[model samples]
Target: MARRSTPAKKKKTAPRGKTKTGKKPPKKPGGFKRLMLGAAMVAGAVSAIIAAASMLELDRAAHKAVNDLAKSSPAPDTSDRTDQPKQSDMDFSKGYDAPNRPGYMVERVPEGENPQNDTETIPEPRVNPAPKVAPLPSPEKGFGAGTELAWQKFATHVPDTGNAPVIAIIIDDAGIDKPRTERAAELPAPITLSFLPYATHLPEQVATARKRGHEIMLHMPMEPTSRVVDPGPHALLTSYDKVAILNEMSWMLDRFTGYVGVNNHMGSKFTADPERMAVVMQVMKARGLMFLDSRTSAKSVGYQEAQKFDVPAIERDVFLDDADDAAKISQMLDRVESVASKRGYAVAIGHPRDLTLEALNKWIPKMQAAGFVFVPATDIIRRNGVKVTG
Candidate 1:
């Protein structure tokens, strides 16, 4: 027993973390696990950044597409004038032969200011128009009543002709075609030029025409007999109420200054309505504006209605360029001469067509040499002894 108990063996302790049984204890998580967790966090951050960049690229693509589309097309016109003078207020007056044609714009000038330097572009009536304004607050006020009638105040001065038959060469539908209108204004002095309200550069056009010794009148649009023909923007229609009619009139009258009166433009249907005509005459009388009955319809009550309301009135004796044929226009001029010879005066309406202008250029000087007097439209009204009454 003493020998067996002789050298007691010391327990072998495992290196560092091992058990006495000589098996190593399981390794706790350390640097390798920490490195893996950090790698996972970095990968997540990269994925989020990639997603954000992709979204931004998509947004930029959308914006570029929109900008490209915008660059491809021109903005369409919201309001008035292009040529063709049928029921559509056909801009037959514009001269297509010229370059640098002015775009349609309603340019207005303030009272007592020269329009020669004005560059502001005002808004015009729309193609498919609704009233852009409310009825005038006081339609009757500032319309030139009593002795300060518009017709008398604005009448172009003309030298009296002793015992000569007068002829009024009224150029209708002016100002739409700038080149043609400018050419028309260069014609003989005291020639009456009736302009459409929808034309652009109205103040400048009117001012120039006046300076050249031309009498100005408003070529007011009215309903035509044909439903297919459009009477143009802000035209006076039979369907309009009194307020609507007056509102349209106000818009047109406010376009430019230095005008004697108004005459109908293609108003075959509107001039035929007695009620509508009566409404027109009332405004004329109230405003002291004379009425030139275009006599568009055989059944038109324009003159009679004017008489009833005591509006200084006259009817067209002839139309010089209805057919646009040179021969026809020339023949019509002869007829105008005959009519003037018989009635002591004649009112002939024409346009600024190539043929018409050519015919007029030759005829005017010839007629003047033959003792025929060229006078303003207002002079013809006066020759008939029709005075504006209060």
Candidate 2:
């Protein structure tokens, strides 16, 4: 005890500052409270720091996602754009131009071009057609070489033997003016076209006559009864020797290619002379040609000489177109028809006059319709079976 007295009563620590009512001040915070306060403060500060860090992380992540998306997406391309043609603005001539050129008009369409719309429908061009050609005429029976034997046998069997009446149409004086001869060629029946030896159209007339299916004959001019007659260049006469006659006949034959026989033109004196006729028949027999006596003279020995030479021979039976009148020619045709009907056939010679042609055009058809078989003169002769003389 001693001095411990009143260590100053510990001075009560001035009663640790009192409340206003003098209640002892509450004890200062304990260590645990201090610790809890400190912990709460630290937690609040940490929460604030964590919230700021999270907000910063969210912003950075959003920015990075936006950058990645921008890198992955594709960019738009605008390279080959062009304006299209409207239907009205389309030009058909863009690729092709010349239609008249050879290959341009024949070009094929391009690949992938729309056939219904892009292709054009062009009208076809017009072209002229070719003209028609006339056909050739046909031959009659008993005319050609093949029918010779048959014609001979048939001729012998004909019932009417007396005079052997037959009709022969002769187209005389025809070897000039080719077109005129061609016009005569239109005659339907087998008419004998008498060709002048030296005429300009002799060959053409002969050819056309054959083409027209007519018979051909040399129109030999001989010495006539009257002084007015001038025999043509190759006329046969009694004054000429056998050699001269042969030469003249040869010269005349050379001018034309096809001739079935010969007929006298103004040969009244020459045809009447028997020796001269015999010389002519000998030449004809050697050349395989026939003879026709025009009968200008009643004393003609032409047929008699032909018989002596054993050549195919014939005589003129009628004269057609002696008058230029159509009515008169029609009368002549009617006479021909009557004669042909009475005696199997008859012969009629005519000129190439327009009147004769007109009359023939009218009457030939009528005759044909009336059962008249108009045949070649050679056919008539062969079928008649009269042995041809010179």
Candidate 3:
């Protein structure tokens, strides 16, 4: 039993076409072959390093080219460059003299993203004190001189709104509050904005206003009634002789462009004087301008002088915000509406006050509902209180 041996077990064989699993052991190369392989690897590494260095050099050259180009070339001419890319400034496709304002543009941007429409935002107005271009030509009488050219340049394009009562709103003391002034210009309704000649950036501000479908006018500061009230520096005074008054007005008139006429700012004493107003109207007639009597005084002879000169003329029916307070301003706004309703057309003068602006923001649109169409000062000049009055 002890000697009895079991049959020897035989190893099983793999099938004919089957292969083993897992990784196979690496095969060794011969000496010369290995040397060749090593040399190939080394060459590949060297080539890669050279390619990387070349790419880096190319990047540097590209950057240097851009820098050189920037240094040698002048900066982009943003002087005429608008906020957006488009065709002409005055071309409008839609309703009632659509805005042609500086920041309002339809540009070809990238394939995506909204085009820059700065008309809805506050425009950062600027005026080049000494522009590189040559100055405008000297003033001549009656033709290319003052408001005649301005009528072409500054007057808002009006639609044929037949038989509609017009409301002309003039905002005075502009160019100070860039935001409110711009907001006033942004109104969809056509209105008028009068700028103070003393403001620093007259050209840019006035240009923006004119582009925004608003008529432009110069707010001519003059002597106020009260002795304590300071109209401003170089104010036209009743005491000034005709020559002095004309000179002062000329200085103010030459300050900017695109204004159809002048409106009194605080000229209580000066406007009341018939002689002073006659002097003012003489200059206005020579310049081909209309006059807007702010009517700071019932004694003002401005409208009378304008009539005498055959100059287009109108007077403010209501001062929108004599009081800066909102409630009072709202009442004044009611008065503006009442006056417009009663007279069929009205000219309302206001300052760039917060309360006034707030009131206007809400009330201006009411003109449409109130059965009055918004118009520029030029429109009122075209139609004195006679034709438009109910």
Measured with C-alpha atoms, the lDDT of residue 92 in candidate 1 is 34
The sequence of per-residue lDDT tens digits that candidate 3 reaches over residues 1-390 is 478779999999977655686445676888999999999999999999999999999979856744543443233233432432221333222222234321211112223322122112322322211101111223554364233344434566677455666678898877755677777787768888988776667799887877777889988877766654555555787666554565677678998987888888777667877766777776776666668887776667887777776666777776766656788778767766665554456677887666777778778776687666888877654442212110
Model 1: CA > 4 A from native: 1-146, 386-390
lDDT of 1 by residue, 1-390 (tens): 355556888997558855668876777789999899999999999999999999999978856744443333333231332332332334533444322221221112224532222212222422221211111112244553344677877887677665687888888878877777888888865699998887778899999998898989998988776665555677887766555566678788888888888998877767877866777776676676778877666667887777776667766767777666889988989887776665567778888777888889889888888888888877766654444222
TM-score of each: 0.63, 0.56, 0.60
Residue-wise C-alpha lDDT for candidate 2, range 1-390, written one tens digit per residue? 356545444434444456658776558999999999999999999999999999999979856744443333232221321321111222222121212211111112234532223112222321221111111112233245433322132121222234333456887766543455667788766667777675665676577677666777777767765443455556675666555566677677778667776777757767877766776765565455667776666667787778776666776655665456788877777777765765566667777777887778777777767666666666566553344222
TM-score of 1: 0.63
List per-prediction Cα lDDT, in the order shown.
Answer: 0.69, 0.58, 0.64
How many clashing pairs per prediction, in order? 4, 13, 0
| Candidate 1 steric clashes | 4
Point out the worst 10-residue segment of candidate 3 by lDDT: 128-137
Better of 1 and 3 by lDDT: 1
Instruction: Identify the candidate with maximal TM-score.
Output: 1
Q: Candidate 1: how large is its RMSD? A: 21.7
Q: Which ten residues in a row have the lowest lDDT in candidate 1?
A: 128-137
